[model samples]
Target: MQANIRHQVSPYLVFFLIYNSQVGVGILSFQRTIAAKAGYDAWIGVLAAGCIVQVFIWVMYKLLGKANGDIIDVHTNIFGNVLGKFISFFIMIYYWLASVSVLIAFIEIIQVWMFPTMPSWILSTLILFSVYYCVSGGFRVIVGMSFLSFIFPQILIIVLFIFPLKIAHFSNLLPIMNHSFMDMADSIKSSIYSIAGTEALLMYYPFIRDPKASKKFAHLGVLFTTFLYTISTIVSFTFFSENQLKTTIWPELSLTKTVTLSFLERFEYLYISMYLIIICALIALFLWCSSRGLKKIFNRKQKYTLLLLCLLSVILCHFNGSFKDMLNKYIIQMNLWIFYCYIPILLLVLSFIKRGKQNDE
Candidate 1:
């Protein structure tokens, strides 16, 4: 007999998972990526991007709640049978690609910081299997795992900021708007990429115990995430010169190296070791969401579909050239527009249209 699975995530847990997932390895590289384009005003660019993302998340939740359906049903109502299926299929593909790219990026980060001698294929497969195992266990299990993963964030924040009074120079963040607004605008695309994972809300909406609570939690979650991000960014900037920071690939980790603790020669290693848990949780969340998206769009068997997604992501990770370069070419560009602007605007329009039709009827 098939077992009936229920979504057991509370609003707070939902908030944690979404917030943590959004604050992944992307934060490690965001400063350099955006600073390259926006100069010292990258924080301003990130703020602008956050505002846009919040509006988009609001619009998405409104549309999804109004339609009161999964992604497939939402699209079907908005675009009609054929076109809706087409669009839903497009979204499904997008989610899959995003999941794969995130997985590859996480692996690349590990390779760079911790395991230089490990083979990429072995690392990729191990991580993919771990993600798939959690995903196959169902949403409640994954959310539960996410709550436990919260330990990593607690440890990370504490380790990195304990002696905060001594290590950093606050002046690095001042005179922040030294660059033109035009430069900030040019870098908005990359800033959007750094905070890109929140769109997972579109897929996980139905799992939220009280759908109505999503808006409240999502807003609160975004606020909290922004606060943490800004603090972390400021700390990193304050610790390293803009010129030195630009050369570091993962400035977050590099900044952690400044921390001095008893019984610890290299705290960054401990931080990285703990961060592996956080990244694993993120991978599980993304993989599960991606699988659910495919099942919703195509009416596929969930188990088989998730397995297929895991295999596909592993394959994508193996594609030639640097994972960073591949992500820039494909996932970053694709999601920069889709997650940041297009999908959100589209959802707003759909929500308006659906409400209008209901009132008319």
Candidate 2:
């Protein structure tokens, strides 16, 4: 069901939702992954990935405009009711897995970097519990949380990068095109997952007041995210040698170690603690999208679906570290296919069907 007037968010809030959702755990280690493929030209890959995501955003808007509803309605409109529900079920599963991936990935970061002795299950339970609380409040609460999440970490985190510039070697980015075109193309493909998550717009599009007016704000959000990622990639490239950059798992976090203050011995500890807000926003958004999809398909209450998905995520988080890694890898691959391939084809099919109906009329 479409959100009522009281529940609908202002179009401008789309800026925060799109931006915050795209900047989660992936950005932390993306430098290493992209650098391994394109060397110092990884920033270019980031820019290219942003452009690609923008095109997908446009396509999604067009499709939603035609359906005049969310993805569940689109499926049911184009396919018969039985097949559409079947397809919608798989989409819900994908959203559920995406939420679980974000949850477990953040827990792993806390275990390794923040508190080595903290058990995964304990943190998982706590995080999912918070997700349950926020999501049960409804769409408006989730939008408020997304807005806070974007504002809190962005300025402080970007400011920390200034310290790294003291040691930066701008020359590292020289011979920028040394890598083959194919190499850069590979890097862009790798960067897709880091840029993934904007697809949540499909689920939430119907909840925006004056959904058409939200387009520019949504584009602005993507542009802002792209700029942030490009700058971070450039800083990471210049701050570390090519070999050093390739070896470092979380280059952005490592860059923080270069900062020092009179009272704080390790600034990254504070940074990581503050970063939990960003991670919480991410988990909450994905969980909300999944539960919303469930509610739409089953015509059930969203709170019940929210409780079910949150508990399911907590259970899955208890698996071994290796299983978590494999799951993350699979989720990224699925995202690449779903956004790049499936959305485009679905758009084409919907357009043709609409055209045929018009001709018949």
Choose the strongest candidate by TM-score. Answer: 2
The superposed Cα distance between candidate 1 and the true structure at residue 349, in angstroms, equals 3.7
Tell me the whole-model lDDT of each prediction, alpha carbons only: 0.73, 0.87
RMSD of 1: 2.8
264, model 2: CA deviation in Å? 2.0
**lDDT tens digits by residue: candidate 1, 61-107:** 77677777566667777788778877767666777776666667777
**The CA-based lDDT of model 1 is what?**
0.73
Candidate 1, after superposition: displacement of residue 209 in Å?
Answer: 1.7
Query: How many angstroms is residue 6 displaced in model 1 relative to the true structure, after the best TM-score fit?
Result: 2.9
Candidate 1 deviant stretches above 4 angstroms = 1-5, 320-323
C-alpha TM-score for every candidate = 0.91, 0.97
RMSD of each: 2.8, 1.2
